[model samples]
Target: MSTFDTDLLIVGGGPGGLATALHARRLGLSVIVAEPREGPIDKACGEGLMPGGLAELTSLGVDPAGMPFHGIAYLDERRRAEARFRGGPGRGVRRTTLHAAMAARAKEQDTEWIRTRVNTVEQDAHGVTAAGVRAKWLVGADGLHSSVRRAVGIDVTAGTPRRYGVRRHFKVPAWSEFVEVYWSRWGEAYVTPVEPDLVGVAILSRGQPDLAWFPRLSRQLAGGERGPARGCGPLRQVVSRRVAGRVLLVGDAAGYEDALTGEGISLAVKQAGAAVTAIVEGAPESYEAAWHRVTRNYRLLTRGLVLASTPRPARRAIVPAGRLLPSAFRFGVNILAS
Candidate 1:
């Protein structure tokens, strides 16, 4: 009889979960993934993969087709500042497309799948059994409200300001080669071109999503074929720990600060690799330190920016500050992109 059903059992089938499956397969581990949803998963996201993130996904042999953007553009009524990445370009891929590509890659790697929700998680010193599968290890790649995180007693209460994000797609021709962020008194709007004739707009704020809050961006997106809007929120998530016995938390399930810097996918993929490495080496505890190292910059910089953006005077100065200090802005963008 097999000691365990598989080497790794992954909960949730989002991009992060699928990425974990691919990495585990690459390390010669038998894997099974459980996801409640069918078909490609979609979420309310900015959908722009930074250059480094695109490269990471490609290295894993999971590249999705989308529009290309050179860098980032910060725009406001008073000023506009743009910065191109030093090396390659970021791609504005739709969430569904990205998820499909990741799932296909996981399937190609011979990963098993279970189309069911993981309502309970049980683990001991040797292995974990979740969603009815017993494995040497369990990875929670679930989203912000991960059941596994809660079940394992690692979930933490978010201490930062609560904010939400709502996104919609518009049918419009590509006008620029940059991911543009338009600022207003209310919140920030991210415009990314996912297809030649499709642009995704996501607004982040504390208040309810009302495009009317941003007059300029609303006017720009006026009268277009609007796709169904999706919302996700209270962007910040804290965690007491990442590893509990044989179970490890990855991606948003591990913890999250905010989406302001757009590093979620990249960080998730990177954390997936680290989580699998620790599992393969028989040192699940090491993943906690690795997670901190990987997310240090994201946590600090994103928190600082979010704080700076809260005050009206400071928010108004954001664009002009970037414009006046191009080098500093470029450095910031490069750090986040990297």
Candidate 2:
């Protein structure tokens, strides 16, 4: 077999990996992205973008004007409180559109896209090796159970898997301007507007996901009408791991916590930027320190949210607190997350 060469070889083509490649290419770095699939598409997500995420898009030179999905809508199902992002400006595009944009942008920057699944990764003091290929640096942007993470002997100590997540699309009238989070003792469901009259509803659970619980919420958002049902396997738990050598991991590959905050993609993209900056400026040590600084508060906040969802007498107080103290609660949440 012949060996392949590259300055940086990314094994996963998801947002984290793709974002890294895009930024690195802009920085005049030789980059190659190995994505098994040729088409660009969004991964499984609730589909909400915050201001910070939009800022990243701007830094990447992407324009949201043409994409499908605009605005944000939030609903407090239990508390009956809601907000809309349409007031200012956000986005509510389908996963595919977002993915296509990222893929196109990466290509525009001259990133060499590869269609191949990695067989294995062998590394040493120099760099990482995969399929007889060698790269100066390897990134594990793959998902929760990343192939790169496994190949590096980096095992994730997981918390119990929470609820089963289900989602579906509906051709409904325009909803609010914020990503709505319906809070109930059962769990939290999010309704996001992707187009002029299209929305995606995602139901997430803490203990065991109950598909039936979210359908009503979905119906309520779709103009008091139900839409097609969509579902995914049991929700993932809090996964945190960092095995430092020649290779590094980011996105869900590094750690995957509850998706309740709708911060996964944004956090992943931001972390990818951080990882690249660290690698270029400070090498491995800087990258490690930056990663810790980035995810430190996020981990604590997510764990606290999980507790709020936990069904116990003492923890049950979250329901009342969230209901009676909306402003106060949001203030604390904002502080903790920031």
Candidate 3:
């Protein structure tokens, strides 16, 4: 028999990994998380937590402080459309704030942490080892470019219409209760109210982002204290599979589409639950199907929207279509929300 340092060794200490730790602890499994960064790690994101996602975090005893948004609004120079969430209001939390809350909750649950980056992985029929820890199962919750995914031989390739996102905070009061998305020929700018006096703007585009794309939004943000910018890219990551032996992928490392729909964190949290459940069942490979089920709606809707918005004409029609077909818009929003 092989002795193990923990029941689960999770690489990356982001929301997904922490959530996995919390779930594992709840199920009486010892977990060790390896993350190179310190607490309150910030990332380039829209910062809007959908109602479903907020509920998931709450269930885990993590409630980050931020502004509450009732729905999502789509806008252009001439038109606008809004879709309210049916269940409850979502929160727009800063990435750092969310991370801190999750980390604290995981700590309270007795999840151990190792400050190291996992570059290589070694697993056998008995257990897996990485970052100097041995465990019965391994989970890769690392971001888009996951080394563990590669170390486990999971094939990944970049997808087309390669999109990138750049985000920063502005010291201005939020004007809308809805998370607003301003569209232009250049790209889309997502304005999420993360705090009463601060809003986060994330630009998504095929090329480098420029605020000139949305003149009105730029003007509205003029003179506000601008924080340092952060960026992430080629939003679409095509993964061949989610499971390799005893290792399972979660969060962005599992797979990714585009951030246009704003449900990344929610999906990550949900996936963490599924991953932990698979591990607890002693059937790691079952997580692959579970992953597909969790991400099916997000994949279909987000991919279709991304494709539709790729063309300039279709991009221009999005808000108008939502305005004309309010029921369809609400249905789509509610589907992703659930």
Candidate 4:
């Protein structure tokens, strides 16, 4: 293994970590990204981009043409959105496409990347150490339950783990214009436009990974078209957590919610900018403070989604109410998505 030194070290090359490397390089900071995985790692996600997050990409100067994707669309069990996203362009690119583009950008910036799993991280006043790489600043772009967060002596409170999600992709037409999030009593399936012929699909429920409903989820997104014959897993995880320290956690590393909201990847991208800004200037608190404000709205909307996916009739009742009163539902969503 090669021992490296830099001004900043990022441990994870997912969206959050990659964005960190990209921005830090632009600012002329000496940086290295140590991602255990090579290329784009597949993830269970709806892959929808919101306006605020997309704007950040433009601000960073990344051209989406390099990674083509569908525009936007929205749908529900009850009423349907008559208009496409009033906001500017947002893509439903595949996770691999987004990752590949980011990887390409980071490499172009000469952000030293190491493809190896981090054994652990140790931190002090000067900076943090991951695997063997050390730097002046440390960022945990890792994920929920971040090893960096724990190593930095930060502990996060987590709601009892509930809700699970499974995401897969297939060729489909844009039945609607925005990423269609189909609300249901059991769970919600989000259909996203990733490419001209491909759509990313996900079904998330609270507490457990599901299997039985894959067929139903496929049917909804297809507008009656036949979906993949096999099935997808119920990718399951907890609701939320907060890691506080100089080494901050962003994206799912910060917290997780129901995937049906289609905000995870975009949220990570947004937090990456905020976290880098916080570290570059000198006040790390700003990143944490800012993240709470931004992440809170998404959490609120996601919590409703979590409740709607629950098996209990009482808890699941929120589904129809949300579908019927999109204003109330959309209010939280708009706050989060923007």
Candidate 5:
């Protein structure tokens, strides 16, 4: 048998990567994590942690502070509908705050971190290696464009009408208890309250992000202190598979559809636990099926909604549909919440 430097080597240092490190440690595996960026890392996101995701993080002993939201609200020029999560409220935490909390938790669990990016991934029967570290198993928790996924020949090409997200913070008083999704002619604007006086506005659209496109949101945010805008995506990535040999992929690195549903963080955390379970059981193949189970709801619902909203007329019907079918809409919200 070959010797290994660590029980597991994790690529990427974002939330998924750090969460994997913490979970692996809980399973008695020694882990080394490689990440190029320093904390607390910020990304363009809606910043809303769904109730299910919040519980997952709390269960992992990571409870970050932020504003609480009762549920999700859909609004348009003519219609509006809101539903509260039956279980609990999701929190709107800043990306940096989330990163700091998760990173601290990982460090406290004794997971070692290397400040470097993973450029290559090599594997064999006995072990896998990346970023110069050899381990019994390797996990790719890197983001949308994961090098490990590419190295393993599982990276999927993104197809269009590829949606993109741009998020900016405004120093304005939050006016609602629900995470508001404002639908306009061009795209959707997600307003999440991260603090008592700060709201983050994230736009998801195929067209270029112009505030003029969301006239209502633009006016509401007028006169507020604007923070630098951060952007991400063409918002769709497909993976041929989640596992190859002794290496596995987790979080966004595994596969992604869109951020329209606001389930990213929670789903990633759950996938981390599943990935570690498969690693601990010495069954990489099992991770693929487990990944499917973990992401099934997200993939199906997000993809279906994206498809439904692709056409102009259908896009206009979303808010009104929710308003007309409150029960059905609430069921959808509760399903994702739990």
Candidate 6:
């Protein structure tokens, strides 16, 4: 008989992994989270949580503080379009704030944490082992460049148009209640109001991100107290599957699409629940289909938007099109938000 340290050993203690730990504890499963980073982990992201994602986190008993935006806005030099989520408002919380809330909730539920990084994984018919611990099941919730995914031999490749994102915070009062996405010839800049006096700007593009690409936005942020810039990507990660024997992958480790639609965190939290569900049911393979169901809308919509925005003409047309077709824009936004 094999000895187990916990029922579930999660590699990575970011939002997704911590969420998985929380879910596992709710179902009476012992969980151990291995993460090298300390609390309040921060990352480069748009920092806007859709209503659907907020609901998921609320259900998990985590309520992070942040500015609440009722809708999304797309803007260009002259045109602007807005879409309010039909369901409710989404919060624009800093990455660190969100992480801290989830981590605290997980700890309150008595989830164990270990300080270590997992470089390799070993699994057998009975269980899986990594980072000097053994568990009946394992999950990889690590980010874009996941050592756990690679260690488990999950096939992954970079998607086309190879995009990347960089984000920085400025100590300027948010100018709008909506999460504003500025469209430019070079790329898009996402301005999210994370706090009353703070806004996060994330740039996504095919090449290196530069705020100068949007002259108006650059001028608006010219003299604010700017925080250090953080970056991530080649945005799209194409993974072959989400299940490997006793191991499962969630969040970016499972697979990823471009962050053009700003649904990454919400989708990740949903995936965590699905992962824990499959584990509780003793059907790890079910997680693949569950993951598919949870992420289908995000993948399709985000991928479609990424492809449409690849060309200069289509990119320029986006804001105008949103203005021209307000109903369509609102419908699309609400679908993702739901």
* The candidate that achieves the highest lDDT relative to the unseen native structure: 3
Q: Whole-model lDDT, candidate 4?
A: 0.65
Question: Per-residue lDDT for 1-338 in model 3, tens only?
Answer: 99999999999999889989988898999999999988688989889999999999999899999999999999998888999999999999999999999999999998899899999999999999998898999999999999999999999999988999999999998889999999998799999999999999999999989998998899889989999999998899999999999999999999899999999999999999999999999998889899999999999999999999999989899989989999999999999888
Q: Which candidate, 2 or 3, would have the higher lDDT against the true structure?
A: 3
Instruction: Kindly report which residue stretches of model 5 are placed more than 4 angstroms away from their true locations once superposed.
Output: none
RMSD of each: 1.1, 3.7, 0.7, 4.3, 1.0, 0.8
Q: After the best TM-score superposition of candidate 4, give how far the Cα of residue 249 lies from its true spot, in angstroms.
A: 1.5
Q: Which stretches of candidate 6 lie over 4 Å from their true place?
A: none
Clashes of each: 0, 21, 0, 16, 0, 0
lDDT on C-alpha atoms for all candidate structures: 0.90, 0.67, 0.93, 0.65, 0.90, 0.93
User: CA lDDT of 274 in candidate 6?
Assistant: 96
* Local accuracy of candidate 2 as per-residue lDDT tens digits, 1-338: 42448777887887888888877887777888877887865555777665566668768976553222233223333434322233234556676777788888888888887788875888777777875568778887887767888787776765664555666766776556566766655777777777776777777765554535555464655444555565653445344455467677888888766777676777777788887876676376677667778877667776677775676553445546655766755554443323
* TM-scores vs. true structure, each candidate: 0.98, 0.85, 0.99, 0.82, 0.98, 0.98
Count of backbone collisions in candidate 3? 0
What tens digits encode model 5's per-residue C-alpha lDDT throughout 136-203?
A: 99999989989999898885989667999999999999988999999876889999999999999999
Give lDDT tens digits, candidate 4, residues 61-91. 6645322323333444444442234455566
Pairs clashing in candidate 3? Answer: none
Model 6, 105-194: lDDT tens per residue?
A: 998999999999999999999999998899999999998889988998889999998999999999998888899999998899999999
Candidate 1 residue-wise lDDT, 126-145, digit = tens = 87888778898999888999
- Alpha carbon RMSD to native, model 6: 0.8
* lDDT value for model 3: 0.93
Candidate 1 backbone overlaps, count: 0
